[model samples]
Target chain A: MSGRTDTINELVRTPPTSFVDSLARARVRDRLVDGVAASVGDLPSGALVEVTLASIRRARSHPEALGQSEEPFAWKPVFVRRSLGLAAVRSCAEGRFALPSAAVGPVADQAVEEWERTGQRTFHWEPWFAGLGVGGRAVVLAEAAAWATSLWAAFDWTTLNSQVRIGGMDDLWTCPAPRTVRLKGRSEVRTRLDMVVDGRRIAGSDGGPSALVSVSGGVPSEGWREDLAYLALVAGLRAPDRPVPARVVGLWPDAAEERTVEIDEAALDGAVDRVVATVAMTAAAARSTSDDRPGCTSDSGTLVGSAAA
Target chain B: MAGPVAGPVAGPVAGHVAGPGTSGSTPWSASWQPLAGAALLERLRVTGRPRPAADPVLSSDLRSFLESGLCEVLVEAAGSGLVVTQGRLTRALTCRAHRMDDQSAEHEFTIPLATSALIDVLFRQLVTTGSIDDPMADALDGLSLDAHRAPLVDWMHGLAQAERRELRSEVERQADGLRQRWPALDPSWLPRTQTPLRAVLAGGQIDLSVYVDLVIGRPAADVASVAFVDVRSGARRPGHRDDRHLGALVEALRAPAPPFAVATYYTKTGELDVDPVDSDLLVAAARRCLAGIRAMDSLGRGEEPEGTGSESCTMCAMGLSGEPTPATASIGAISNVAEAILHVAEARVVAPSTQTYAQGQAA
Candidate 1:
């Protein structure tokens, strides 16, 4: 009475149902699964090695390298030199060096005692005698002097506070160094800069109404203020209200005040029009380069005197 | 779904239902009338409702089950009484002893997974010991307590733990034997939650804190009331035991804070309180916690197991718990499991300059 007989014969097919399609389809599906699993098993060894190497690199092997190194000078400028024979310039302006640490009373305590005797707010000196194990203090002292020259290119008299010695200490050997000084055994480097300030507008030594804005960039590219918009505003040659297509850096010294926005040379016709539309400008002037050698790589400029002041 | 013949319909009236004379109904025709209508109604009835366990099983032979798949009479039986219920799947703890979270727990705390093998192997240990727990700690505790049986104890213990996770050891053992036989068979299982540090730092995953808010259930209240009245005390009000204290706990459980992890800091001596979270909030918290773990993974990122030179590393399980030493961030110390073992790694984050670092303290 039931219709199970035909359906049962159809349901329990082994090799072929009607010998044409079902057998062929079953073979295709089984083959596909085998192929997928087999391919999954064959992952390459090169990819494994890449992952292993990457993990190792991420852990970091080196102890001394801080952040990233950028361009020609890989390290931060620890010392700035103006003329020569000055104290060192240090990039770490806010921190104090720890004492050699083996000392019984700790270096800070001993330095505080020395500061009490000296009666000054700041102190600048290195060890005269290499009585301690620090025999190579001279190497540190020399670098500090080089830094002093560069930093003091803008300032003549760097302060010396005896009381706030290197991290609250005053002993030449045991003490901390002053926050803003490069010291070599009580000697300080002083370099003079000539600045002309009329009310607020600062002029250069050559009687030009220009302010030296020193822009120091650090390695791995981050310490140079990342905001290009802010930088364009300060550079004054270009106002960044829109995308101007090309990046520009303007450097001028002892030149007439740029009354007009200067354009770069060899521009296609639409380039000047784009600059006028994008950058804050008076009438556009013919593009000129700043000095080629010592001061700048730009040729003939009455358009820029940028910072590094 | 084979159909009627594709040839022309040149016979009776095209719209009429089937009748006896034109098709020449056999003697079984009258019987099939009610049966056919009944079959149609039966299919319609069974659409949403289950088949009432009247669905045939081993009792049905090929002739009996016209639609059910069977060649010879089926052997396996699933009778009408085979209905499984929710209570069978779920379990609850008989011992209501609360677990001690790290901060509130006693210093130098020791936990003995109490009772005979019945309790230790079968019950509390089920909740406490697993790959989810510290395997090394579990192994050490097992060895110390039942080291005499040695190989036998370990075998039994492994079996019990495997059963706890509802995985049969025989399956793994069979796989192991197969792998041994087939030298090229490489079987590796990775945790679902753990992605590499690069992926986490690059925001490869959708940020956990954002989507985790879609936890199961309605949103909870923000303000929490923590009442400290004990009805058991003579001086305390009895009504507070049920009304206020539990009321607060139930509310807190349902509606935890926005920042899922909040330290309940006591003002007097800088102590902390861990509040109970609602079931839904807990689930949401669990997923969001993965992000914090992802963050920790990035900060320590490819961190070496060696001393971070911080005093906090003292409590690090990845570091030797008893003694601090330089070592490879020993074999997957940065894994999610390691983060759980070193719960303090998530709990306490102290930020100080190199000078004020706790490790810099006088030895």
Candidate 2:
């Protein structure tokens, strides 16, 4: 047991954490701000917001109350100037499209969905007529929440460890003010899920990580209603320490009539695995191309074998 | 008097996981104290070897059949390495098996654990959740499974049945043709003489019995001695750089007290003579094989034992291609020296502006 613990301990300390400098953090910030600016643009006018708010609040005079947070932070932009920055992000990252692109698409797609409709411009609205009922504002709120969450998510993506923000109404739309990247690496041999369950103590209830399930109060619906639940299930159950036999099944289409234990479990396991693996592979490919890993700290650069590539 | 055969006595436990609970690998909960060395796999190989004549006819025919240009080759780019066209090999074998009249057996495309972990993770996830909306379904269509299975499964099954029936009918159809055309022939040579393998537990019961022995036997050569050449891509490279791994493999092959032998098997293009490994290779490979392993040991330096990285840098397990990209820094490139410099600079930048000016004047 001691030997095993020792082995585990070594895995913890041995790997290099980074090869790039704070410059990496700076690069990440630049890409993110650029991505956002390209997709969506500046905030909405107070008059426009006031009108939309008034229309929705007619049923209830205090318009700020409906699912809308009274908390001041909730007042920030949703589909406006923030989306342009995301658009910029999408373009810059478009070239290395495969790396963690899956993660990016959810955020961008949601923002795009908000941009195309703009709540004020939905089929339900006549820019002249009350601009997309409360539902439209709901969309804006959802989009804003999503953008904010994604910015936070970017912190996960960037090298800048300091506090960061994604979308603010004024001055810098998505500012981490680029300087340098100093990123951290993931752990080795934490492959097993008990670490998720017990060791790493990732505080998720039986339902699973709320972060995985929730974008915020809002679901990134365009990317939502998709198989994120399925993905969450997979990530939750993935056998880290060793391989496990798995099956992803649904009630077979024909089973609808006699919903009683209709035994048909199609193979979805390998498909999901491919998606996760592709993300890792793509990132490894980028680092390999730059031959830049050589400059990063050993822990952060890559797994011993991955760096070789 | 004897023990299990000198091979992976357990062949993936017939669709079982390689962890505890059932037939999978060591469970995560169970502290992984992988047996002291290759010593375990090696010792097991020796005491449990299956008996055979000293000089059995080396199945060179199997080798020639596998490597021969009798089938078409296919290749795909995999993230870890080039995915060689094993399709030709599989097809050639299937055809040969049909011609020889052995239709019931099945062969699956096998991938090493390290290379296939991503798939394993997804599969595990699928098992847990049981449903994938259009998003996952679209991503899955791009893999070898869909590509290979879609166009081939039905075609091969049809060919198998047709070939068997056609061969059988040819004999009856040409009793006259057989006599004159095949006077020197055994007469039965033209007929399909295969005993198609099939098993049935009941009308709808699950029956999974096989006649062939499918054991895992590593190549006899040391990791250093062998070369992993992509036969289709013509991408050939030595299997290992360090010789210590090779020495471990050798020790396993020639375990005198334990008694092991190099076991050989034939694949489409070549024959692999493998032996049970000794204690050394496992330890050495374990230390270095992280890079090759899928999605594991990256943060902790897959090869090194004591390393840590951040959760942000972790590649998304979900398969969303359109999701917002993580920062380049999130991919992890900051060095310790860089970190120190960054901290100092931050200190310089954050320190009182007046203090900085005074220090500059004194210097």
Candidate 3:
């Protein structure tokens, strides 16, 4: 626990101010975007996390496995519960309402209802919800409500502007590049920082500094700061116009604790390096599989290698 | 928070069903009727016409099963990207000439994006309070005033004095109309605006997603108690009734039993058209959705699905010849469509960023 805490503390330390900071940040963002674009070239669009996890798994087990089909990711009740809990907390935060455990059920119900209404089968949680008995569903909803209550209690909702606090699954940041390379950034809560400009309190524009708040579970894990940095990087790349996120705050409800990662040149560079490596690995894995296919063409190999280069 | 209260009264109204489906019973049925799963399969058989022989293989086993009634040969195509939305489904069903083309245009999205953001803000406010005092001001305040919405806001602010005056007056009128017509919804109803609805069909091989404008009622309520509301700005167009029915179908499929009803409200005309959720509505809506999925599957297979020439073709940008000039074009519609298009584009741009950022660090 002490070692993990130190790692988390070191990751959250204040960043240095330097003249080349902006340039460094820009370079990192561009490299990350280009790397992601290269690896994701014309591949099926998926969340960054999904692609990374899949790539890592593929790399470890049978990296040469040919003709493998992507397996459907099954979403469990815990995912839905977490998502619903976040939504409940967000609604309360943005609407300036008191947190209530009862509010969680409706939010969960609405999520299910929305999933059904939209016919988006990609949600993956529908089957889980459908499989639950009435009592089982109630328990899930209760747990979600409790989770939301804990989160709401942990934050000072009034300090944040109710109107500006973007929450839920809505604020997904996406960067689509040539050859169908697509990357997405998902945050549970994002809000613009108010800057004092010329003696006037003005809300930052999308291009201006902003804070990203993510809700997670358990103790701070390895690469947690890099994750936040990557989110900031992707968010910046997607907008290009918007300023890189000022800071990212990770909230762990179970522990009733939080870790803040300030976005800086070093953070951006770290994120870029990690993403480039992941994308290269994914591209290599994809290439290996494609090479073993029945009608494999040399052209496909060239494309993958050149893109990853 | 308060415990669940008694459900709202269900009743029927007289009007053409808005998006798709047959007109029959009242808006709210006295009893809940579940949409049988088999009924959807039957509807697909009736609606999903076969495409050309040269069409590519329908990729997923689930899709092929839905189309050909054969569950075998579910080949999961490696890395296929397919996103089916309500608008795309509506277009697939209503348009005669369908060609999949990139319709990305910078200018095409200006008006609609602004309108949607404005409307979304007002609705969000409405969910908090039963009524809106000043729609324009309230909406402006609610906007994050970010880069994406800045142009829309600027355009809004750049209006001529007279135009601004007219806009404000219109906003006030619409807001008042919405307030008067809107039922005294309990805060406990947990009304949400711009709620996303997604589901996996055919064993997670096909994904369908859409966003409902406003939804009220608890999921824990009786299956027949939840209600879905769609807000529109213009006079209802042809096949618009089917859209509402689609909303009903979505709710019915997701609910413990079936939803109570679904309604479409026209802010411009102050018209509210309601349709009871029934097996018939679900079947009809499912047919359209299935037909859409089939069309999408065909498109995915490098085959052009036949389009049923209709009013939707006017808005189709697939470069089909001899298309009629859009008859339903209006300032409101233009803005709405623009906003919807840009909203979709923005989401695409943002989704990947968020996912990557969070996932990258987690890794």
Candidate 4:
């Protein structure tokens, strides 16, 4: 089989151990931080930019499309399946083997309770979920259950390292740029190698070089390498003091397939280019809107306004 | 060689029950997959859950026996061979002449008169998210999202207002029935909808394919844990009992063991007929399968298919006429083209049909 196929087979069949990058951790983070700073230098002050793998890909492929106004995000069955599925996975990762069908409703209720306690109606999911009729709620449960089953079936949970991180807020990286910019890399599965000291492998509880594992839909695209590398970059940026992830593993469960991208200098640079291109496109889109209507706070009103708000 | 005609097949097995009153006191082990959702099925509940007598060793032996027998049948058949689906098996057993007609006919995309497919789509949505606002609108939107259903969706949109109203009412009635019967299934049951099973034989030339509407519970328990539920939007048919049987056989071939129970939930009448799976059911289903494959092979060889003078003969494409002939029905109908056509036309006029022939096809 080809090397690419071999990498995916190894990834699916065995616990990941061989793909660890040999690059120095500190040097790589410095290079990535510098790249981020240079990329967003031209954006206006107090502009909030959130770069996700989706955003970077869209920026590369459909830059002009970004400038056009977007419809506000709605709560579709397809949209929240992953979010609710991840909650079930969190429970599973913590040794509670509950199916998505059983866990999603309770977790959603918990989220609404939390939202109610804080009196935060900033996001409409809690209210929308709370207000749905029995059938509508059941539809949400069905969609999420299917999503969770896919994730659950993809990995043999018993075989993974006990410290595997499922999903949470820790994956977000707030880039230390002049403007308010954040790169979010919400991975489905995260595993760290045992920390080694003096050439002997040490089973440290934490603080070891890790790998980011994510699940994507359908097949891998041409920008898959950059997409995974962007996640690795965000993970590194999120914890600069710790070691950078050696690699990023992407699994497409629908096809029973996977792709691995080693997070070396080239992959990180590609990710940086995509992020820079994304910001540039957003700025151009904002400027074009401003030119069309002759200025009414277009800088803040464009991409940043909707994202930040 | 004489082909096994439809009427000679054995009568319905004794294991199935039409409605509720099943014992529900089975204590579940820790590793056992839970069927908390099945427990709520008041109408479809079976008497004391039937545990599989076959252990893993016995299950493996049964699979090998079925596979070898099925493989032998396929090896004896001619040409590149056929993919045996659940629909084909049901048809082949109920009426061989009709099955042959379907096999010989060319497929055409026509506007559906029946609302079962729409009801099915809506029912699936209900399964996923236990609520629906407008059945007609949700079904349309759901159909629109599917690339394959674009043509059907467009056709529905172009339908006359009267037809649309009729269709919506039919769908709404069924949707109500579905909601009334189907309980809020516990997520712990790990209810999976539209689960497909395929078992290949004769080097992938012959595929036994079945798409179960809903499969509850996981396999790998001490007792049989998985339960298969088939949703039906129309009135229940005698042949419908074979659905879960066929599903169980195919699942047994693939999984470590067969599912514990199989149910058919009729959405039009709110009737749920359930049966427990056992070695006898699987063996009987296998015998029927072999007979169907033999009939299919006979058709493949260009031999004329025999007609059974049963009640469904009125709707039969063969248009066979005359009284029920238990002994000679296979050769009873020798109608010429014009007579056959006239008989079919008269049957259509005489039959007080609630649904159009096309609508029945959708079901």
Candidate 5:
């Protein structure tokens, strides 16, 4: 329990309550804003995804350079299992389908039936399903059942408002900047928390408080907090109206624990700074790779090098 | 599951009568065309003008006929308590007329389940936000994911990089087309999508259900004011008229007042076919529903209805035995794989959440 509390505390600071304390909180928010803006302000617009990809590529290319061991180069495929599992959870929450545990056999059958019928083959698992042996197919279904069961057991879904829309997989927000640079945010579950007035539930708005749920394995050692922050930033920027996410929850189902990051003005600032730093690293790596190319002319190379610098 | 009960024939029963025209080839301009929203309601008002109370003996005879003929089918279909939905009823009626075998019946069931899932997701997004920013991405987003072994996930994982890219591109194109052609529904009309309507029959032994894709106007409003819209994935089928009629039935059963209109929108063709709801239409729909229940009862009793000898009968599973159609092939491949998965899941059955079940009961 202490470990879980520590995890949550790492991301969200206690809110100031008193009038005098509120001013102190505002000052903290302003300082964070200034710091974050300065970091990401210089990058060309619409480069967030490019920069994020570049950072991963760079990390892959020179693991030793970042004090890490190197691994063979392979495309890190998108996790379809996580997406499907989240969807099942959402469907259950929305009462569209009975939870997997109620009838695992039927639930799994229907899920696969839907995937096939819909002609969805974009997932990395598509090929795996095609080549799967009988035993492999069984294993896949077993895993689906287990995953769905775990999600079903995790929360008290009945307490949530009946009108609350449970969205899974497809929540994406994009904010375009100068130079065609854009920042995108993806959340596994974007639950628009319902407002209760006199014990009656009302629909949530774009500006209303939302809880962004991200599914992952165990907490990562590097940039984990920033990762959540980055997600918050994208959600804030992409929000069609006012009031971005009030909090982000990262669920590690394997560990059966979750980390919550409260989004204050300061948190937003921190997220932007992290994005800017990642973009800068990507830009630097791109420049170095071009400089090392044999076909590059020295005069033109310097210009490229100077621009990167 | 007894054989159909033999009884004296009553005067011109409901389902036996010829329904309004549903032929896709015939031009709609040939006769009375479907009326749009407000106009349809106005027509209903005129046609449904209150009449003198009917003879008590006649009303009693009609009720008895409905109970014995229709209730028997519903009770049999709900054997051990199965939910009977509008879709299921529609299938029973269509299959009975076509004399479809068990295989064809199952295939028909699979098609709509799949299509409805896709349409439901899209409709949810539209009603929630009033627009879709990225159709392809949104559709993909609706899929559930997990990190462990899941057939769909595994299949997605196994896709070659190029193949994955190609799939995404195609999805984007289709999504874009859907978004561009999506009807401009006013959000203020209180548009709601995938709304579930349920009514129990045969003393709650059978649950007759229907899900309207997009419903405009509020629940408390006059029934004639609310518009019930059904979204179809492909071009309008001859059976679509039955589906619209079912919509009318759903409205009549659930809402205090009959709906203003019932319509179907074909996603591919971007055509909306609106039918006005009148007392006569409701009666017709009620008769069709009773016929469907009766058919289900016959099937339970191992009695197959005679085929109508329509051209559509050519596609029935009874006559077709050679190479599988594309739909059949795809469904077979997928269902086989899904059946395998279900076998494993069944072996490791987990206890369902009591709270969730209780919540469902509450709903």
Candidate 6:
């Protein structure tokens, strides 16, 4: 659907149903939990290590580096665009669909007001945004508008499944392997499942499987499947009681590329292996550094690393 | 982005649409009084009629015509297709010799953060936010977002305070002119900035790429509805009237219909030159495009290209000094001033030749 000129409607109309049953999902979760625990068993207690897709990619690219160098992250326009664009898209989805150019400033203002009223520093965005002058803020709005416009144009919203969710809580999995390791996967859209049992629809059934959509920036890579698998693994571990996503679609609008990965037991196993490797890398990085391990702050203020990879 | 697929409409000519004067305040601004954005929109709305939908047959025919012309040129040169961007097209059309040298040049030069580049970035902000505060600071912050410009940013940071102040003043003045002339666009207009357009012709032998500064209106409407605007910071130059290239490219890129109108907004003078799109414009643009491709091919084969020796080519590397004879002093003065400012700023960033630039400024 990326560059084929076909609308996204076709992709979601007759989605392939999930074949992995309740027992299989539970088994996958148990395997992931055990794999993660075993990977970080030797790490000292209370040593918090953050693991994310970016850290995994970094570790893979720089295998020779003993420890990951810590750099204080600043809010660049690109990062701000993604953050504010997500909010604008959410606004469009909830109220009315307007061009991103018009929605970004108002949504940004609303965010600032919300922060001012609550005085809760959930994320660093509010303080950073408040500090910017009008010129800097205008730049943020312009960048975000372009970002949101690309996303809004990528799909025909009126034709998609009715239960589409945009920019909510991303899939998160926190593991207490005696070292308090956290894993995160950022998803842009999720189509909630609509299932009926005995001629009656279930509100939120544990067996139902939703579809996750990740709108990425760069071109799709060879590790796209693994990337989606990691998200599935996090989703599974986050809610071990519920079934994982049925499918994960990664959309790269700039490159006009899209790839879909179906979640199953084998896919979850691959994801578990990826998590074990990431944990091992993080533990090594932690050992190499004498200073305290620094938790990576993502765009959404997650304690784990960024999902930008 | 292509508009929705609709029925084909008959090609209609939009005549002499005028609006409140967006005349330039400069001495040379007297001749060009383009319509403001509001006036252009008003003219389109008042004169627009319910036309037919997008005609697939017409689009296909146009594509075939373009391919045939491009292929004829390719066969003559016996060369494979190469990428031809809008800049290359403009360069080739202005002076084929300059275009040829530019293509073959091995030296990589950095473009200083001049007023033109600053306006280009700030235009996006204006379209999105409908206003601007400090154009200088905003443009710097915007450029910093691009990782590839780290070297340029470093160079900018190392500039003297006085030089930085001069650049900032120029940027602020140009940005102010832009804001005064530019109108606030509605969201329903669906104004998108820096929309990429590509048209592959002759079985991918010729890849034409261009980015429309701003695009509005929904595609695939009952009639031609979309509009394309190209933002310019420098004085209006020759070949700026050929917006038909943009229209031709958009149509060739699978747009259900050609844009209703194409415009060029000069930030220096707050002039918005709008031209309605007609079949003739697209045809002319296609013809010009073919000529450009043939010229590029000729240059590739080491064949000599003709030089216009126009003031636009005064800086041509082919020794086309474009000296200003007494008969063309007025026109030459405008071009010389703009060129001198740009060339000097570029030199300041790439080299240490500030004395000449300072002398030019004093004169």
Docking class of 1: incorrect
Off by over 4 Å in 1: A1-23, A26-309, B1-120, B124-280, B283-288, B299-363
Model 5, B188-261: lDDT tens per residue? 24344555555444554555567667665433212244567787765556567667777766555544445545
TM-score of each: 0.14, 0.20, 0.43, 0.53, 0.37, 0.64
List candidate 4 stretches off by more than 4 Å. Answer: A1-48, A95-97, A114-124, A159-161, A174-181, A194-204, A284-297, A301-309, B1-122, B125-169, B176-189, B193-363
Cα lDDT tens digits for candidate 1, B291-326: 223223332334322212222231332233333334
TM-score of chain A of each: 0.20, 0.20, 0.67, 0.79, 0.62, 0.82
DockQ of each: 0.01, 0.01, 0.03, 0.09, 0.02, 0.17
Q: Per-residue lDDT of A1-309 in model 2, one digit per residue for the tens?
A: 112123322222222222222343244335434432332222111101111111211212332232222232222222231343343333333433322212233443444466567653322222311233222232232333233322222222222111112222211111221211111111100111111434354322222111121112111111222122222223222322212112111111000000011001112222223222322233333334335434322333222111100
Error of 2 at B223 (Å): 13
Give one digit per residue, the lDDT tens place, for model 4 in B164-282. 88788888877776666567765555577766566654544566778778876544324455678887777555567766788877766555556766777767655556666665566
Measured by TM-score, the strongest candidate is 6
Best of the two (2, 6) by lDDT: 6
What is the i-RMS of every prediction? 31.4, 25.9, 17.6, 10.1, 18.8, 5.3
Report the candidate with higher lDDT, 2 versus 5. 5
Can you write out model 1's per-residue Cα lDDT over A100-129, one digit (the tens) per residue? Answer: 111111222344456567744222221221
Largest DockQ belongs to which candidate?
6
Q: Across residues B59-80, which tens digit of lDDT does each residue of candidate 6 receive?
A: 5555665565455465764445
lDDT by candidate, in order shown: 0.20, 0.23, 0.49, 0.59, 0.45, 0.60
**Candidate 4 docking quality: incorrect, acceptable, medium or high:** incorrect
Question: What is the descending DockQ order?
Answer: 6, 4, 3, 5, 2, 1
- Please identify which of the two predictions, 2 or 4, would achieve the higher DockQ against the true structure: 4
Q: How would you order the candidates by TM-score, starting with the best?
A: 6, 4, 3, 5, 2, 1
Error of 1 at B296 (Å): 4.8
Best by lDDT: 6
> What does DockQ come to for candidate 2?
0.01
For B276-324, candidate 2 gives per-residue lDDT tens digits of: 2222222232222211111122211323112111212111222212232
What are the root-mean-square deviations of the candidates from the true structure over C-alphas?
37.9, 29.5, 22.0, 15.0, 22.2, 12.8
